[model samples]
Target: METIQREMTVFARRARASAGRMHPELSLVSYTLLGHLEERGGCRATDLAAHYALDKSTVSRQVAALERTGLIERLLDPEDHRVQVLQLTDAGRQLLLQVTDSRRAAFKERLADWPEEDLRRFADYLTRYNGWTPPAAG
Candidate 1:
């Protein structure tokens, strides 16, 4: 089991390196944060940081980068002027769509031989593990 786990870690790292080359300048953390916003439509910066267990400063930096790139816009909260809201712009949405497609393609390539059951089992175990594990460090 240790050997298998070690092998999987190496494989995962190689896969991530490949993906990084295939998608340059795309920060995994940034992508992940954007995904959450995409899933929830839009959310407060504070709420997003809390949900992801990330530092507010880290989240803020990422948000600022996205905003500078015109990928996202920090809108003034209508109900509460002090609170800021984050929302994806058209470019951001399109970029996410492209990135999602690339990830699906890559996963399909990597798991081409695995049976449906194997895939399901892997996903199930990952979901179970994630439920208990704390978020990764920033």
Candidate 2:
């Protein structure tokens, strides 16, 4: 268990570091938020916060920074004109794609030597790990 925990921490640290190398302006959090927006076809700030279990203020700050960088914009929701949802700008989408491609290439290179069975097992383990939920607070 200790080994698993330590390795998971290492994995997270490496992911954060690699994110910086991929794009100076896009931190891991920023990249993740942008990816979520793209995947969800845009969503409210509160939705983002809830999905990530992040503080609303934190999400607000990140959103502001992305807007300042012209990477994201707010659009009125079609279903609710009074409400606004966050969406990536064209620049954001392009940058996201570039970083994604770079990350994918890097992964391919890094795992090129791994056996196919090992890769499949590793992938399944990751999926199972991510699917785990903590017990409710006492």
lDDT (tens digit, per residue) of candidate 2 on 1-138: 999999999999999999999998899999999999999989999999999989999999999999999999999999999999999999999998999999999999999999999999999999998888889899
lDDT of 1: 0.84
TM-scores of all candidate predictions against the true structure: 0.84, 0.95
Q: After superposition, how far is residue 125 of candidate 1 from its true place, in Å?
A: 0.5
- Per-residue alpha-carbon lDDT of model 1 for 15-130, expressed as tens digits? 57765765675577677877888999888989888988899999999988888888888888899999878999998898888888988888899999999999999999879866
Cα error of candidate 2 at position 46, Å: 0.7
**Residue-level error in angstroms, candidate 2, position 104:** 0.4
Superposed on all Cα atoms, model 2 deviates from the true structure by an RMSD in Å of 1.1
Instruction: Give the residue spans of candidate 1 off by over 4 A.
Output: 1-19, 133-138
Cα deviation of 111, candidate 1, in Å: 0.6
